[model samples]
Target chain A: MKKILLALSLVMIGIAYHNNVKAQSEEELVQICTMVAGDAEYLKDFRIKLDAGDPPPVQRFPVVLKKDVKYRFSVCNSKDYEGKVILQLFDNNRQLATTYIVATGKDYPYIDWVCTKTGAYHLVYSFRDGKAGLAVGLLSMVGTM
Target chain B: MIKHRVILYQALIIVLLSQVLSSCSFCSRQDVDLSQELIVPDSVIQNSTPQVSKAITDQMMQNISSPVETAALIKGLKIPFNKNFLASTKQADWFNTNFEKAFALGLYGCDLGYLNMYEKTSFVVDYISVIKRLADDIQVGQFFDFSTLKRLATNNENLDSLILISQQSFNRIDTYLSETNRSMLSAVIVTGVWVEGAYLSSRVAQISNHPKIRETIGEQKVILNFLLALLKVYDNDPSMAKLITDFEPIKKLYDQVHITYELGEPEMIEENGVVTFKQTDKQVIEMDDELYNKLITNIQELRSNLLKL
Candidate 1:
């Protein structure tokens, strides 16, 4: 009877540990994009893009220009692995304006500053398996107006 | 020994009977019987051919030819002047020309709607030919026909003529639509009006320098009247009421545009033909998902009420 009880306790501990690990991985996948509204006068044609890579699916969301407008972009993952992601936006001059370090399971890994001029903008994002050094997904320029 | 053997036999029989009954229950688990209905005989099935009715064929033909019968089709369509000209004179010419096209298109759309509903193939074909001829004339800067315009002008005076014709057409086709079709029609009407209004508004913004922009302010007024009429019609129809409410965001956007830009009269052009105007940044409107969802839910409830009607 004692041995049976010991085995049951071990099983319960194993289950709990497994659940904790799963919860942690899920939390990491919930990372979202964030935005900060800068000076109102300088911003024009504010837009958001969601890029999920290579058959190249893109989603564009219009930016509403209110003083307190904030947004977050996120990629959801369904696995327990190191997620390395880069979120980038380029100005009309093809120069990078904002960049963010996005990791798997981190909240709001991507954020952008409000653009203050009327010109073309581009967004690009890449996600890689940190352990394998292989690209898992790439989403670029998800929105344009 | 006989009694013991008899009791054992009874027990064995009971156990077997129960097992058999349980297996039978499992076999008959499905609620419906599969073999109750007679299957088609192979000989009859081999000889059967699909029949097409004359009435259905006639209806299909009518459906195909109605659009061609109404409205003037334009030839060598030049892109309508964009409203971006800085000179008022240029803008006025552009707007006047575009307005004519828009009017023609609107009338054409109305005719198409009527013909589609009434299934009047010959009449539709004849009207479409006339429209095409008119379009050709307009392209060449020649007068095609103003008879339709004259008819419209005198329509109120001679209400019995066109009104009776329209009523007859509506009555013939109105009853044929299913509930789903009616719902779809409501959506189409709402979307159409919204798109047309947006298109007109954008054109107005482009022709901001045109003198006739002020003159054509009446078009916006007409749209508002049309919207009110539509709203009243939809108020009585719950399904349509829901769709109208979905368009509330667009209404608000229009209101903002009207207030911020459209309220003022056209700026007077200076002697040098240059109109001095300052460009200002307009804030972009954002749609809130939560609000839209609530609106949609309300519309669904409205639709349910309409369905009862």
Candidate 2:
């Protein structure tokens, strides 16, 4: 009985500690996201918490991009998580830009896109290795083209 | 019996150890419920329309342009700020319903943004007071930092902070409303902001006929689709249904404005570890004076009708 109770308490402590760390990382993500916004006019923000399936489907959000508007997409990921986020800007199925380059294995903190067409665009986020992660992203208007 | 009890205890220990390992600082891929990722909470569905998904609603809300940007663009045209363009705060007492209050709150917010942009600190007090009252009526008043805003509004040097804080307050309001399954109010508030901003831009374009202002006014055609879609999401509500009917004429007017985009090579420039993609593509707004005039007239007329509510 004593050993059983000890094991139960240990499990509870582990879960609580894990949750505490996650909450702290998410708070830090918001601050880093704001810092990434720099001098641009802050428009919209996405705070995403993802626990993916085996295949890890892309988490997508829609934004209406305007013509002649230069917009910035900035992302700050939680270092506590194993997953590194890949942020992509898509016009339907066609990829317009991305924060990570698969061939070069390079990553950027942000990507700036000068939208020439006024229409709906998708911001697709996914983890590098189909892992669970938490991230915050910002959409800011850089200036008019 | 003792042997069996020992085996049971050992099994329990194994289960506990596995849980602890799974809950370690680094998460593994044991959880795989994709259905959990896409759906809105059952609580949210209970309070509002059930058909629209949270993602669609989120997109709808994001599509609405921030009034701060509109005010800044108008200010950039170098036109003299017109106090007449703002909705009257005296009408605050007349609004009793949540629909009226939410819409009026948006109207006052846009006015506040314009005042903040032009650094008209004195005019901000009245708008802020009315907005606080309206927000309180809707039970979202706690989001606004009234005392801080009041202090900042009194000082011209704090205009930027005032604008940022004010925008943040509205954002908090939207977030609170959405989380509480009252996102319909959030949609209504943004609609109010869009109407007022379009009205301000239209009125200015009439006087100055600034090409930039005209182009901005023409750009409303794109935003209008998003606004209409958001309203349609809640059209089952009688008030929202009426608002959609009200916008039909303006929508018809905007339909005449045609925009075409020509493809060009995108230029990538890297500066100080930052990359910027500059679009060389050009967009042409093809609208004659007749249609532009009609659109402006209808927008002004609709805005006047909405303010009366």
Please report the candidate that would top TM-score against the real structure.
Answer: 2
List per-candidate RMSD values in Å: 27.7, 7.0
- Give the CA lDDT, 0 to 100, for residue B73 in model 1: 12
Ten contiguous residues with the weakest lDDT in model 1 chain A: A33-42
Candidate 1 residue lDDT tens string, B1-309 = 667656655655665565455434223312322112111111111112113222222112111111111111100021233322111111112223322332233234344333323333434344434434433433421222334423532443332223223322322222222111332232232233233323333344343534333222222222332333334433565644664665564344333322111122212222342222111223232234343333334333332232221
CAPRI category for model 2: acceptable
Candidate 2 interface RMS: 7.8
**Model 2 Cα lDDT, one tens digit per residue, B103-164:** 98998998998898788999998899999999999999999888789889876566766876
| Candidate 1, residue B130: how far the Cα is off, in Å | 65
Candidate 2: Cα lDDT at A128: 79
I-RMSD for candidate 1: 27.0
**Candidate 2 C-alpha lDDT tens digits along A1-145:** 6665687678668767876876677657866776787766667677666776578656677676776567889898887677778888766455678888787787888889987766666688888778987788888766664
DockQ for model 1 equals 0.01
Number of the top-ranking candidate, with DockQ as the measure: 2
- The native-contact fractions of the candidates, in order shown, are 0.00, 0.28
| Per-residue lDDT of B290 in model 1 | 47
TM-score of chain A of each: 0.32, 0.80
